[model samples]
Target: MHPPAHGADTPLFIVLNAASGRRDTDAVRTAIESACNAAGRRCRIFLVDGPGKLQPFAREAVERARAGGGVVVAAGGDGTINAVAQATLGSGCAFGVLPQGTFNYFSRTHGIPAETEAALQVLLTEPPRAVQVGLVNDKVFLVNASLGLYARLLEERETFKRDYGRSRITALGAAVVTMLRGGHRSWRLRLAWRGQERDLRTRSLFVGNNALQLHQVGIADADAPEEGQLAAIAVKPGRWWSLPGLLVQGALGRLGHADDILSFPFASMTVKPAASGQRRIKVATDGELNWLAMPLLFRVAPEPLWLIKPAVAPELEAARE
Candidate 1:
């Protein structure tokens, strides 16, 4: 589908996840309303009750946007954004974000401001640009997908947040405790791409759609997913003690220089259990967890999603090339 044109007259339907991040729903609603008023645009905010409500609300918003030829904004974190984006996939309705989540990775990767007011201003002023999306089976993900250790970490982190309150410190503490408990295990898988197959054992497998994230993790320097391929990084099995060193390398953007990491680009790939009887595996996509039937299919969508980005942002300007 062609990119939808956005303007001052374009109606904005924002779906806000009340439980996202640290910001309360009322404050977010106030900020969005204020910004829309200042920009002289008509806006509607839908405060979602929970994760279960996001999909139906987002779908309705997309339907309305398509009928009115406007934009549907996901005003929460990556998970919320992914839910809204899934609805806009082929509708040709522009997708926007307010970036009210912790990391705001999708927003940061796209050059959308992390601050509420600034992000709203950008959405008001910028035109929508078409950006590629990655898919695992029928689900859409904007950032990355992973299996094994990273998935386990996310599960642990969520539980910790639910019990102790959510914060970066708590997340780090959860990671430390979870790692110490020693739950990670190696997986033997057969990876197939371009008619070739190889059997390998790895602690984790990451498939990234955001080129910036890949580069930051020292995996690749891809500027866009428009190349119609996903960047895959494999962490080979290693001693448990080496996990800390691997984490440091990733943080320092030197993961590519490490011996246990393997990185490559692929248009499509299949991951299956090396053993014949194994048929299901847990996968985390853009921080949301799910179980998928194996051999899992990973591929780039044939069409790109239209994203509203700032007209002039430093990160976006650098990515344009």
Candidate 2:
């Protein structure tokens, strides 16, 4: 693998969300500039106006990074990372993170540091590793995607996040309120794979590329990135009681092991709305929620993106073994 030259003084693009984490970007920029100057690298700062502006900022950063043969660093939260990742896809440009968001799920999952100094150290010391990314139709996600009840819950959570910051309590409150208000709804879901298709009346479907622990309790088999397939998990809840059972089963690792549950590996799956004249369904990808039309195509891109991450800690790798 040809790594970006060391100490070669290449340019680095820094994308920042000024209001992220209630952080003071001026201070962060001062530190970054000092560090880059000492390492013989240069840095540029771009402050995103708001959530919607991240996409344009990301595209501009990708173009600049390509022109300068440099790496791009998203200096904010998961939303910022998602924007940059979408732009950097298939571009052969390495992506870096500066974890300035609330959850910072993508950075935390990949073992990227949140502290400015340590994160910068990783960018300087480690080579980028190719990581697989998930795509729902034209949208790219580094985390997971969900439809049905979870998607609706995300809509409420967005308001909560805007009012009150992210916390387990916030999510728990939203879930409880949503459930009490009969938030779960049924849909006719048809998933096709390997020339075989299965249709079911289901409450929701969650497709994830990484083994995610929800509510700090559940574990799903999402470990193999090189498998060249996305882990397709379909949850069908027949009743209100059965709905909560999905979460319980997910917590117990029996999610794919139960009769009511269906779990398998597939390269792609598409969601078609069952209701007539329904133009779109709510969907959340990597915590970025939006609405898209049915026949939503989700596919595995097979390790298409490369991220600069710290070397795996020995204990973590050993545990995996």
Q: In order, how many clashes per candidate?
A: 0, 0
Off by over 4 Å in 2: 1-8, 212-220, 224-226, 241-260, 274-277, 313-321
- Candidate 1 lDDT, 1-321, residue by residue in tens: 557777789999999999888987788899899888987888888789855789899998998898888899999888899889989898888899999887787888778988888888888988898787999987898998899988898888999989988677887788777767764799999999999999989999988898667666666545536477888888888887777677778777788889988888898999999999888889999999999998899998888888899544466446444
* Model 2 Cα lDDT, one tens digit per residue, 1-321: 454433356678888888677667888888788888888788888888666788788888888988888888888877678878889887768888888876666676667777888888877667777677889987887777888877777788778867877665776667666656764678887677788777878777777766333212232445543367677666667666665555556556555555666666778776676556767878888777878888889998744777888756332343244
Q: For candidate 1, what is the total of clashing residue pairs?
A: 0
Error of 2 at 316 (Å): 6.1
Give the winner by TM-score: 1
Clashing residue pairs for model 1: none
